[model samples]
Target: MGSSNTSFRQGFILVGFSDFPHWSSFFSVLISVFYSLTLFGNSAIIILSQLDARLQTPMYFFLCYLSFLDLCYTTNIVPQLLINLQGHDRTISYGGCVAQLFLFLALGSTESVLLVVMAFDRYVAVCRPLHYTTIMHPLLCLSLAIASWVGGFNNPLFQTSLMMVMPLCGYQLNHFFCEMPILLKFTCEDTGGTEAKMFVARVVILVFPVTLILGSYTNVAQAMLKTKSMAGCKKALGTCGSHFVVVSNFYGAAIYTYLQPQGSYSESKGKFVSLFYTIITPMLNPLIYTLRNKDVKRAVWKVLGRGTDSG
Candidate 1:
């Protein structure tokens, strides 16, 4: 145990793309560009959702929270990643790794639940338009948002606590960040029971939310089919389609990463998949919403027009 403590205190080397040292510079630049876009895009969504009166509905309210989550999510991972990619010093302190793991899991789990919540909002809007306002009152929205966040952070507390006590065999983390499955690879003892428990937790966080999102979308699709007017059908599809795309991208990569058996986990493939969720997805979210969403586009032009006139 003392040796384990000393090993942790000494910190672990992040073997991030070291095998492809020549490509590190390229990835560094690409990630930097994506990080900047993620910051700009998600920030714009949050600001527009607040500043535009048209966007003050339940959908945008949830969008604002989603943007905030994406911002924190990318910020937690991208900077450390860029640093590791840019320099030869590929080490992270023990505390930093723990913080990364905790935040990563919490933000991810929260987003999973939040996506389901957004789907529920869409279902209410599409299926029960008459009672949408009554059903999705501001208080209810707030309560759901708060619950998502609280549940997200709570998930990591137990998982991280379990990982911290396990005796590790080495100091080389084979990936870019401190992920649970990758971290498990270093455990020296029999981790079957622990892995099973963590697997159940992952399923709760990943699978359950996906199942809920799918159910909500199924209802939403039925409602869309019943709408006789072409315009109404188009609008409903546009709204739900954007969300479905986001959900597909996020949950697809996350499920692939988390659901696999530990023995079959491919470190090389995992790195790229991690890149997609952590960096690419956040950048794409605002684009997906804005391009497909007329209200958000109008809000953007309104804000820009005001800026132009003031200038």
Candidate 2:
């Protein structure tokens, strides 16, 4: 908030994918479809988790957390992207850009943490079923969720402040969105030290959660293979498969984008990678969960069928 307003007051033009002028219409249409689907899918999950008592368990609780985070995550970026893609006005005010950057990082960082939490939830359900109730109490779940939010909100604070204070040559962003890495490109100083700091932050916010998720899932896998019931083994494999798919979908794009030093960042690569995690992932998540899980499908039916039955 304390950053200088001199360069920002004029606002920055988000160049987006303007390089491909011919594809604007196609991009617009594709993005609109994804945006619409992301909103509807995540919203349905959140509502269904609350409406169906069967979903009152810890898994659904964390599913709702993921749904909510993806909702906020895409809502913060996709609308702006759609507008920039479809309309001539690609300019976001300095304040708007900063806010977008901040919110996106917060939601994204929290979602990364939440994924680990969800993995832990699965581990408990599968590996420690006996004490799952006592371990994942409502209060503890609430605490974990809050900690995720807090960690996310704080991750970008110091770095953003530092980035803001650094001098930038121009207000034109080569990409469609405002992101820390891209913004770092414009800063006037030699970004060697800054890039180091960013890499460290990325490790903390992104890598740490990913490691946790992997560890939790590994435990789940080990425990799952020992189960003698064929039916139970099949079910466990399905659940773990779905979770791994989601995990790979998210972490793959994010790690590729962030883990590298800023010096190695490719504008085109960053643009497409950003497109994946921000637009594509949210749209795909609900489909993955619902198609893969019988429980989610039943919850959807129960929630949507109520009004129809009454009518």
Q: Score each candidate by Cα lDDT.
A: 0.89, 0.84
lDDT value, residue 291 of candidate 1: 84
The sequence of per-residue lDDT tens digits that candidate 2 reaches over residues 138-240 is: 9999999898888888888866777777777677888999898898887776778877887788899888888888888888878878888888778777766
Error of 1 at 277 (Å): 0.5
Name model 2 segments beyond 4 Å from true: 1-6, 304-311
How does residue 27 of candidate 2 score in lDDT? Answer: 97
When summed lDDT is taken over every stretch of 10 residues in candidate 1, the lowest stretch is: 302-311
lDDT of 1 by residue, 75-110 (tens): 999888888888757899888889899999999999
Question: TM-score winner among the candidates?
Answer: 1
lDDT score for residue 58 of model 1? 94
Model 2's TM-score against the true structure: 0.93
Pairs with backbone N, CA or C atoms under 3 Å apart (clashes), candidate 2:
none
